[model samples]
Target chain A: MTLSIVKNATCTFCGCVCDDIELHAEGEKIVKTKGACSLGESWFKHHTAERLYPDALIDGKPATVDHAVEAAANYLYDANMPLVYGLSNITCEAQREAVFLAEIIGGVIDSHTSL
Target chain B: MIYWGGNPAECHPRHFTKYSLTQKGKFIPNGRKDRTMVLVDIRETPSAKAADLFLQIRPGKDFEVITALRAIIKDQPVNPKSVAETGLTVEQLQDLVKQMKAARFGIIFFGMGLSMTRGKHMNSAGVLMLAAEMNAFTKFVAMPMRGHGNVTGSDMVMRWSTGYPFGVNLCRGYPRFNPGEYSTVDLLVRGDNDAALILGADPGATMPQPGIDHLARIPTIVLDPKVTHTSRISRVHITTAATGVSAPGTVYRMDEIPLPLRPALKSPYPTDEEVIRRIREAVAKKPAWRPSPNGQMAIV
Candidate 1:
């Protein structure tokens, strides 16, 4: 059995936003949690990925990260009327960037939570 | 207000430990013992377990409950059983109503379970009304337990940046808002979008069945640090550093105070801010990249 401990991490998953969380990371994978609520524990323990890739499919075909970025950029840039949504879930810095992106595209910007 | 909508115990585990009756808020120094905690819900919850009194109401009976409470506060004869299908007896409800009237300083907090359920914004409206009514009786306030740390901040920043709040249109070189017309659920459910950029949230897990089905048909981009229902299906699933924990930023507490986010861990992905910056750089060359009246982004 392996054991570890750490603290003072915020849980980004919910509104409570518990800022004190402790996790037992067994070499990159979290196995246990201390000082965290059940929800926070579940969030840290499960915040792992099963795959690692920089490239993805845009419309059912494999594309490079640059290609996808360019494509998404073009979609916003070329549109006469566009809406950029989804901000509440990310950090404020990301939200600021999104606002900048929306401005350049002359598009609408919104967070999904406003609904 | 009532816990009629959400079960905070299962969702927000530390609410009681940090802010509710069990916790000693700055005002209520005596904590649970000093405060009269009244719960109105459809079922028993962990938070209710510690309440001084509990009133189990029907699924969609919040409106009725509020009306009765208002009547009681006004010194009118309100029969509790006549108000709704709630399981609480008249005497139990009247006692709770009296406590609410007598509270020196009280806060009514609710969750998404209220907004998404039968009453929708009306439920919030009613709760807000209760707060107003209670003001005449005692010091009382109602606040929504906004789900994300900065979810409320998102709206605040958007509102401050643009004249309108959420669901605003910038295509006309100005901001315009129409709730259902530009809401996320409506946008997805109506299939009005050709592509989507999912950030921070997993619409697949949070959206209703119809909205989820519609999102599945579009070209979607996801920015998340972990695997989620939306990220798994997105065309470009770009991972990012967790905002509050891995990247320092700012957020608004439920009380509308802007709190600085503290980072506690290192991350491999770019901050949501960085990704947005990159995307903004890629799109800035467009023809209509004009700043708004507030010097923010405006439709050109």
Candidate 2:
């Protein structure tokens, strides 16, 4: 069994930053991954199926991605008093973008900070 | 010192295996065996069960118990009769103080149990003060057992994004951080915000009763990998790939150490960044509909 090093993969499953993980693949399939915690292992091993997509939903029915985005936009942009929250578990890039959205809408942004 | 609030066993499963407690110190060779573990808590927690001696203080009496110990450490008189309130005798506290003062190296860890209770930041402030005082006689340090995978990361992001830390306000076209003024609970309570976007956090599980009530009234959008109570009730429930597994990102540890997360699974779904990007683009442009004075959107 040969081990191949995978870099820049962020294990989002837990807090521990175990970076140097090896994904042993056999042709397109990742047969095994080494050097991750139990939570990390489970997060990586079991994510085989595609779950919910980021497309917006209107009354539990799938709406076009553009339509969903537009609806969300309308919700925030139309409101004179809006609050943009929840960016703690996203990438630094996403967080920055969310902040920009908040700024453009003249809205209040909050995270999970207990105040 | 196991002497305080941090319960790693319950929250951070690998804390003992990774950090100061079980990890070998430069001076202490034998790991946990060489160190004296003292647990000070209201009830017998899983971590406390492992302590060498458990000083069970009455609930909400941490400040009193700690203050008495601080007095004893300073060679001041602690009323023997008053010590009864702490559930531990004065002699026991004195003995613990003596050991703390004489220890080669000691560390105190706190948890949300302290930060979330009546004391809030003051409890952590007290713990930090205690460690500072201990430095006078012995080498001691303190740490908070922050939960959530990227909570510390979130804290660092907010601190750097805005000059101030959490509870930031962007109301006046500038970032003004006043905890009660800009906090989620306060904002929700006053019925100030018309819309909300929750990312990665499940406030339904974590918030207080009033705060939860406030959330139910707002137009909430939740983004997460799994279906949570918040996601179930959210006006817009957008599910994305997990950051470290399906998606890749960086996170910060409790010690403010930035680390990269490896993507273990290939996600066919849009990243949180993509979701936010699209939303920003849409919102930045003018909305198609306008709201009437009564708060209903009048379709043109």
Candidate 3:
């Protein structure tokens, strides 16, 4: 297998958000990570392109992505006071989307900082 | 440099080597040799080994300690007996104030130990106030040691979008700010919210018992890369690509500096941004929930 190297890959494991790590990937997995601490190394190595779980789940049962999305939307729309929480581990793009969703659904939006 | 209520040695392993202590900066030529490190916490963690001076304070006394320091810096009279209750004497506080005033540059990095304790925000406020007052003697600043990835980014995004950082409410069609009322933990524990959409965090594992029970009672939706603790209990769990690993986007440092993520491998799942946008689009397709223009409040 050919090894592919990516330089200056960012690690979002902690608040430091170290961005100088070097990632070495083989096929679907990250084999080695240089310049990253132990936490960051495990973060990079833990995630792989391989499918580990079902795409979506509804009420502990396997369901299609479309069905799950609709179910989620229906729940949020039907509720009087819905909440959108937990933006700690995701990216800024997703956070923006979450804020918009909260606004449209007339809900409260909070992050881990409040905890 | 002062590390207050934080264990950087174990929590942020590279903080000493990468950012604060050992780095040779323009002002400090000798790096570690020229700088003095102080640590203040309830217990002696591994980080105490790295500090030149360690002060083990009594738990729940952060506010009192910080206030005492503030008084000492301003030359205000403080009762020695009262100071002793904080697990540090007035003499020790005087010496610390001396060192702080003598330094050319000073910084205080406070962590969750100060923020999540009994006094909570008041403790943080005392630290910030102390740092601001220290500027009268030297260049001193204080920063919180934020936890989790992109938490800072979420604060930034929410600030620019809604005019508030966190604990924002838009139920009235405009942004309203109230922490104890709108914050997730308080809302969940009080059973105020009827439904929830949780992303990027596992509150089921970390929240208080009442909050966890409320989440279980509500229709909770989770979006994450794996089937996490929250996912198992949620009504809908959507698998998404992991940020900074298989999904590319932006993350912010604790200092609020933005950094771009470069993925090394392709993932089979959609990104959180895509999933949220799809959910929003689906919600938009439903009938509008907007108030009539006659009852609409104007944005002043």
lDDT of 3 at B227: 95
- Indicate which candidate wins on TM-score: 3
Q: Sort all candidates by lDDT, best to worst.
A: 3, 2, 1
Q: Please report, as a residue range, the 10-residue window in candidate 2 chain B with the lowest summed lDDT.
A: B287-296
Candidate 3 lDDT by residue in tens digits, A7-39 = 999998988888899999999999999999998
RMSD of candidates 1 onward, in order: 4.3, 4.8, 2.5
Error of 1 at B74 (Å): 3.1
Clash pairs detected, candidate 1? A89-B200, A93-B273, A94-B272, A94-B273, B173-B299
Model 2 C-alpha lDDT per residue in residues B1-300, reported as the tens digit of each score: 754665666656566766656878778889988878887777888987667898887777777777887888899998988889868899898889888888887878777666666666567678888899999998889876656666667677767877765667665557887766777877777777777778877877777777667667767776677666776566677767777666766777667788876654566667788888888887656644444667555544
- The C-alpha stretches of model 1 lying farther than 4 A from their native spots are A1-7, A22-33, A48-57, A60-62, A79-81, A103-108, B1-4, B25-27, B75-82, B85-93, B163-165, B260-265, B289-300
Interface RMSD score of candidate 2: 3.3
Q: Write the per-residue lDDT of candidate 2 for residues A1-115, one digit (tens) a residue.
A: 4434465455544454545667654432346676656665665666642654545564356666567566677777766667776666776667777777777776777765453
Q: For all the predictions, what are the DockQ values?
A: 0.45, 0.46, 0.81
TM-score head-to-head 1 vs 3, winner: 3
**Candidate 3: residue B175 Cα off by (Å):** 1.7
Of the candidates numbered 2 and 3, which has the greater lDDT value? 3
Model 3 scores a TM of 0.96
Write down the TM-score for model 1. Answer: 0.84
* Number of backbone clashes in candidate 1: 5
B6-113, model 3: which lDDT tens digit per residue? Answer: 998999988899888999989888999989999999999999999999999999999999999999999999999999999999999999999999999999999999
